[model samples]
Structures are given as C-alpha cells and as structure tokens.
Target: MVVDDSPFSRTLLADSLQQEGCEVVGEADSIECLIETYRQCKPDIVTMDIAMPGADGFECSRALLAHDPKAKIILVSSMKDEETEAEARRCGVVGYLQKPVEGEVLKKVIEGVMSPDVLYNNLQSWSIDIFKEALGQSITRMTKTTATFVEAECSEKNISQGITVVIGIIGHYPGSMILDISKESAEKMAEVILRRPAKGQDEVVAMGAEFANVVGGIACSMLNKKDKAFSLRVSPPSVFYGAQTEIASPGIRLHCLYADSDFGRIYLGVGFKKGSVLWM
Candidate 1:
C-alpha cells in the first residue's frame, strides 16, 4: 500500500513496485484514508509519505502503528536529514527512503523490513531451484535424454539401492546430498555415456561418485553466484553401498526428490543446516 497525497508520486511508487512483481493492494491520499484502506487491504508493506496535507507522515505512521503494531511501514520523504530519519526511527518506522528513491533501493528496503522467516523461505526456494535444475540438466547433458521428477517416497526417504554417493556442502549453509541409483542402472548409464560396457561394480562406484561431484559442484557454483554470503563449496564425494541405506542429519531442513530418465530413477536426499560461521 502507498499513502501519498501527490497522485504522480503514488503512481510512480506503485509502478516501481509492480515492476518488482509486487501487487499494489491499496493507496491512500492521507492519514484520514489510511486506516480504512489498510484494514480493507491488509498489505504486507505500507510506504508512507512523510509530507502530507494535514497530519504529516509522522502522525499518520503513529496512528496506523497504534492500530496494528505489526505493521511494516516505510517512511518516504524529500527530507534526507539525520534528524528526520531519527524521528522516523523513533516513530516505529521500519525503513526510511529519501525522495526520488530508485526502484531497486525501495525494493531492497522493503526486503530488509521483511521478517526473517520470510527471507529464509525465499533463500530456501532459490536453493531448491538450483538443486532441482542442476540434477535434471546434468543428467540430460550426460545421457541426452530429458530427466524429470516422478513419484517419490515421502516417508523415511529411504534408498533401497546398491550404491549411494554422499556430497557435502560446506560454508554458510552446510548440508549433504545423498544420491542413490541402483548398480544396474548406474552401469547402464555408464554404458550410455562411454558407449561401451562398464567394467564392473568398481567402475560403477567411481562413476556414481563422479556424477554426485558434478551435480554438487553445479549446485555450489550457482549458490556462490546467487549470493557471496552463501560462500558454498562442495566437499569431495563419498561412496557407500548397501541395501536400505539411510543417513541422518540433525538440526537441518530436509527434502527428498526423485527423478526418472530412460536409465533409471535417481533417489536424492537433500538437507541443509543453517547457522554456519559465514566465510565472508
């Protein structure tokens, strides 16, 4: 929501937010209209103009905040002085933006005011995207056939396969990816890639490790590019073999996904634990 007396400023702010893919839920010209509009729309962020007709931005902010203590409000004005900014801070304003604020600047301030859980959820989404796309594209590049997620086990997320490769993710978000593909399937994929018969279980194990390495490296590279804070690095692949093998990761967010291709189904168990000492 935007509360500004000037139609041009309101339109500009709304347009900038819309370009950022945010919906403009409500707009108010002054404090008189802000409360009703807020109650009706219940927007996530309210950008309040400091200079208005009657009450000014400070009183308006206080009024709205009194109504909703949890309201995330941003004060915008031509006043860039420290005193004005301090006053805004004292008024419970979560963010302050000077007039002629750039669209990206406004977006960053809005993101800054967002709750930690919301921000973490966004990071989780981006991380999951990197993992899913890396696995699918890597397999497709290797086998020349499209791979996609199929029906996957939700309970236990177990791997009832002959071989499992563990890849460690280190740095900001430490995690592990357990990749499992049966020995026969691994051999078939090796045959497809090498255009020859796979040597045996030895070669299959090596190939499986290499496959996990490639996928893990891709995920880490993408994350490192996403944000330097992620500071992610892929650890050397570890290989294990058994029937009904599973690994436990305490204090981590976990998700299991399975993808299928002409070769076979790939069972992936991915988990990440936060609170690592950031590398940079």
Candidate 2:
C-alpha cells in the first residue's frame, strides 16, 4: 500500500514496490480514505507519506494502528529530524524512510521489518565484507585516494537530476550493479581519473560508467573467488540522466554499499533476484 498526495510520487513508489515483487494493493491521497483503503486492501504493510490533506502521516499512522494493532507502517517524509522520527515511533510506525526513498533501501527495510531473522541471516550469507573490501579497493585504485566506508542504508528513493551507471550481472546469480552519484561528484571523479578537468557532461558520464564497471568487475571477481560455483559475467555499463530517475528490479533483493571520498558520497548497489541459490 502507498499513500501520497502527489500522483507522480504515488505512481513512482508503486512501480518501484511492484518491481520489488510487492503487490501494491491500494493507494490513498488523503487520510479520510486511508482507513477504507486499508480495510479493503488488507495490505500487510503500508508506506505512509508525511504531508497530506485533512491529517498528516503521523495521525494516520496512529489511526491505522488503532484500527489494526498488527498494522506495519513505515513513514516516508521529506523532512528528516529527530523529533519526526521519535514521533513516528510513538505513533507505532515500524520504520521511517526519508524522502526521496531509494528502491533498494525501501525493499530492505520492508523485509527487515517483516522478517528480521531471515533478513539478518541473508545479509550474513551475502558476505557483505567481501563487497565492502572490493568497493574500498576499487575506489582507491581508480581515484588514487583511499575510500572510507561510511554508512549504508536501504530505502525506496528518487535520484533527482543525477548520473546513474548500471551494469547487469549474468551467471549463476543474475542481477545488476548500480552506481549513483551527483553530477558535481561525477565531474570531480572524472577530473581525477583523467588527470584533467572534465570538459562536459559526456566525459563525466563516461567516467562514471568506467567507475561502475571497475567496481562491479572487482566485486564479481571477489565473489566468484570465494565461491567457484558463483561464476558471473558483467554487461557493459549503461548511463542515464534525468530530473527524477528511479531504478528498481522486480523479484530482486538489493543491497547498497556506501563509501566516502574527496569527490562525494558514492552509492554502490547489488541486486539479485529473490529465491536465488546464492541466498539459499
């Protein structure tokens, strides 16, 4: 279930959820209709937007919990503050995702809340340490600057007006690897890689793709080395730019790795289809 005043946001979020193998049973733009929508849809989870007509997300969340004590609600809002998060928790919200939520992050949060034990075991099995090491090494090798692992979060978000490089993974565990960075960050990284200032958007985008390719290649190699049966092939990187670009893959469970450098924050993501042998 998705609730938002903006039709565009609703559609975008719904599409992302659907791509994550979630069935969007219902949508509501106002709190007045939220109860009815929830009752009719009988959704297991709800993504509630903060701002809306009549009542805000906090109140609606409380109402939903009142209606159904088992309701699992995650508050989505553009505002990020301690007070908001505390209040959301007070209202019985299970989770909170700041807008614009990234699809990978959102899916993880949902799964974590739904089945914490399973999510925790899956994360452990995924060998997050290997991916983190690969990311750190790749960034240092490409940029000649040490990259530090900051923090990683999962959410459904809109990457507004940025450069995104996507590389598809094909083999025993087919999936995709994506790198999303701001234009300014791309330009800075491109300059570092080229040993000169990036001239235009084309150069920046190309450099971004190169960065993603190197990182993806390294990660895949490391995974395959750890498990001989996990042979993986990476497709050529694809780049895209737009005002508000969202990416998601249906039936895939996504994980994001965050690294910080002189340029800016880098979001490295790996996604594999649910029920893959890799997870089992």
Candidate 3:
C-alpha cells in the first residue's frame, strides 16, 4: 500500500515496485482512504507520506498500530532529519525513505523488513568515518528543521554507465554538500526523483538541472540548521561533460553502487575547502 497526495507519486511508486516483482495491494491519496483500505486489505507493507490533507501518515500509522502492533509501516517523503526519523521510530515504523523514490531503494526497504539480519549488517558496516561530520550544533539544528532532503538530476552522457559526486561545503562554519552527476545520470536521477520515466526525452535533462539546484538549497538549509543565525549561501552548480572526469579535490570521496541502474561510480564529496569558490 502507498499513501501520498500526488497521483504522480502513486503511479511512479506502484510502477517501480511492480517492476521489482512486488505486489502493491492498494494506493490511497489521503488518511481516510488509507484507513478504509487498511481495514479491508491489510497489506504486508505500507509506504506513507508525512504530510497529508486531513490525517497525516504518522497519525494513520498510529491508529493502525493501535489495532495491531506488528504492522510494518515505512515513512516515505521528501523530508529527512533526526527529528522526523525519530518520530517515525517512536511510532514503530520499520523504515524511512527520502523522496523521490527509486527502484533500488524501494527494494531495499522491502527486503530489510522481510530480513532483519541484512539491515542490521548494513547498519553496522555503514560508516561515518569517511564523510566529514557536520558540526554538533549543525546536526542539532537538522533535528529541529523540516529541510533535510535533496532532489538531484544529471544531464545526458554518451557513456552507458554514470557517476555520482558528493561535494561538501565548509565556511567559517559548516555549510552544505552537492552530488553531481552526468547529464544521463541526472536524467536517470530525474526518473528516480520524480518517480517516473521521462514523458518526453527533453524533460529528463531539463528537470534534472532544476533538481540539483533545488536539492542544493534544501541541503544547505538543512545542514546549516542555524539558517536564521548563520545564513549560509549556496554556490551555483557546475556540470561536467565527459564520463571520465574525477572529483580530485582534497576532500573525502565515497563510492556507492545502485542496483538495477547502469549509473556507475557514485562519488560522495565532502566539505567546501578554503581557496575554492565560496558562495556566501
């Protein structure tokens, strides 16, 4: 089951799950619809939104859990932070995913619920060692705000596979991060972020550029956490043309792999070092 206000999100999420051979039993646009559907279907898993017209995903999950404690609800939204994640955890939600939903991420959520051992192992091994830990104060701010989410898209690339670059920014204080990708990777990102394949070939590239910009603004705000005080500024994003371009900056770069997608070489760059172009 999926509960979201956007018909686009519902269709995209359902299509992606179906492609992975998972059965999506029902789709609901509001809390009332979800409650009614839940009474009838009792789906094995549910992907719900944080914000809704009447009763949000959180409230609906709580009501259902009141009847059956073992319900596995996954909170899915464009919002991310310690506070939001903690709230979902308190509600007994099994997992949390940031928007926009991608096939690999959705599959992982399902598999994690079905198999606890896999999730535990991944959690244990997932390290914060390589990435720069944003300042303690900044992290604290992240917990209090509604801005901890990103939406990135890449442009088209002739290369069959793609690369993801995560770039971090640092000022007199901690700043933000950016994940740059090839145009093809960006479009694929759009397909994932928007949760659907391109209706027109041009949309992927166009939307992807906007995705990077918007995601950067959101991330910068989230990372700063003290936006009212610090007022950090985001630099304009730059696009690289070729497939072989590397993130050669001195900051840390972490490589990641995505399932079911050909975008190869995901790089996570950390910190905006001194002497680099610093946007106020």
Candidate 4:
C-alpha cells in the first residue's frame, strides 16, 4: 500500500513499485482511508508518506501498529527528523526510507526485511547509545508541555494558555514524547525561521513544525547510521491549538518531562510493542 497526500508522489511510487516487479495493491491520500485499506488488505509491506492531509503518516502508522504490532510499514518522506525516526521504531515499523526514493532501494529494503537473518542484522544495527549522542545537543527533559499539546499535565506544571503540541513516538528501542507549552514557546522557536518572534497562528505552527522537523531529522540520522540502518521512518509533527483530548495507542507510552526557562512542558512517552509478542 502507498499512503501519501500528493497525487504526483503516489503515482510515482506506484509506477516505481510496478517497475520493480512488485505489485501496487492500493493507495490512500489520508490516514482514515489508509487504516480502512490496511484492514481490508494485509499487504506484506506498506510505504507511507510522512505528511498527509488529515491524520498524517505518524498518526496513521501508530493506528496500524496498534492493530498489528508486526505490521511491515515503511515511512517514505522528504521531511527527515530524529524524533520521527525514533517514533517509527517505537511504533514497530519494519522499514524507513527518505524521499526521492529509488525503486531499487525500496525493493531491496523490502526483500531484505523478509529474511530472518537480515532482520536480525538490521535490529543489531540500531544502537541507543549513539542516539543519545546525536540528539544530545538540544536534548533536555521536559517537566511542562511545550506549546504542542492542547493540555498537558507534567511534573512541573499544567499548560493552560497558548497552543499545545502532542506527539507520539512508537518503535523498538522505543517511546513517545509530547512537547506541551504555551504560545510563548512557539514564538521563541520561530526565530529559527523568521529570525524573529512568530506573530500569528500560522507562524506558531510553522515554528512548532520546525521544532518537530529538527527532532525528526536528528532521529532519522541516528537510526540510519547508528551501527547500521534498520527499518525506521519518522512522521511529520502534528500541531494543534487550544486544549485537546488524550491521544492513546497500544504500545508502552513513555513520557519524558522537560521544563525550564525556554519551552514549557515537554512530555515524552516511551512504549514498546515487542515483535511477534503483541496480542492486538
């Protein structure tokens, strides 16, 4: 299956897969449709886009993984982020690929994962020590939420004003991290883009998205290079303003609390859905 919001991307992926002598079973432009298709067709592998219309690839991957822990989902996107890659592993994905993907590369990765030896080798390649190092630069545990989640309860305090970013990272070597904070958090992050404070909701989302972008980018690099590459793909960050409901999945949600003078509540949840061991 292929899940992407861009019509051009979907067509290109389908054509490439067919050229590789692989069958293109189905395609979806949004998360809801992708889930429905997954239920109907249990394809051996899935190549999903990082960004989508409604749910996005990250949310879609989690939903699919929740239903089938061993689901062979590959994240294919232009947006590369460390947090996204880390989340993909936590989500139990079988593979991850970057955008402008070549058909040969996709074919090789798909065939490689099917082999028990290759899978073992890939797993051996992922290292946690290196991940800490790569992300260690701006890595700080959050006690409060960073303007990502609508409403987040943290060790330091509760977020009430501004926007909240709620993100879930799922995979082996796994976990989920939510950055909850206020509008102030978004404003500070905007400097990276506009060279100044963000002035509106659009600016805030862009900044917040960039924050996710950085986290996901670093995570992807670590996952690909640490020891060797394993199947991992990070989804684009989803940002929402105001208070929202609790988002849940089947994996062991690990929350990391980082709070200080900068961003507010940053909660990260670490969850594991051991391969071949999940009931759902």
Between candidates 1 and 2, the one scoring higher on TM-score is: 1
Residue-wise C-alpha lDDT for candidate 3, range 1-280, written one tens digit per residue: 8888989888998999999989889888886676788778888988888887788778888987887787778888888887886777678887677788777667765775667554433322332222222322222332221212222232222233233323334332333344444566556555655668777645654554454445455545653453222234556555543456544434323222212224322233333322211111
Between prediction 1 and prediction 3, the one with superior TM-score is 1
Q: After superposition, how far is residue 68 of candidate 3 from its true place, in Å?
A: 2.0
Give the TM-scores of the predictions, in the order they appear.
0.56, 0.52, 0.44, 0.44
lDDT of candidate 4 over 1-280, digit per residue (tens): 8888899999999999999999988888887687788778778888888777778788888888888877788888887778877777677776777888889778766766565455434543443333333333333322122222222233333443455454443332333434445676566655544666667779777666556545655655676554232434455577666665353444433334333434444433222333421100
Candidate 4: lDDT of 106? 81
Candidate 1 error regions (>4 Å):
1-120, 151-153
Candidate 1 lDDT by residue in tens digits, 189-226: 99988889887878878988998899988987887676
Which runs in model 2 stand beyond 4 Å of their true positions? 1-124, 274-280
Q: Which run of 10 residues does model 1 get worst, by summed lDDT?
A: 271-280
Judging by TM-score against the true structure, name the best candidate: 1
Model 2, C-alpha of 131: deviation from truth (Å): 2.5
* lDDT at position 181, candidate 3: 48
Candidate 4 stretches with Cα past 4 Å from truth are: 116-280
Please give the range of 10 consecutive residues that has the lowest summed lDDT in model 2. 271-280
Q: Distance from true position, residue 182, model 2, in Å?
A: 0.7
As a TM-score, model 3 comes out at 0.44
Cα error of candidate 3 at position 158, Å: 55
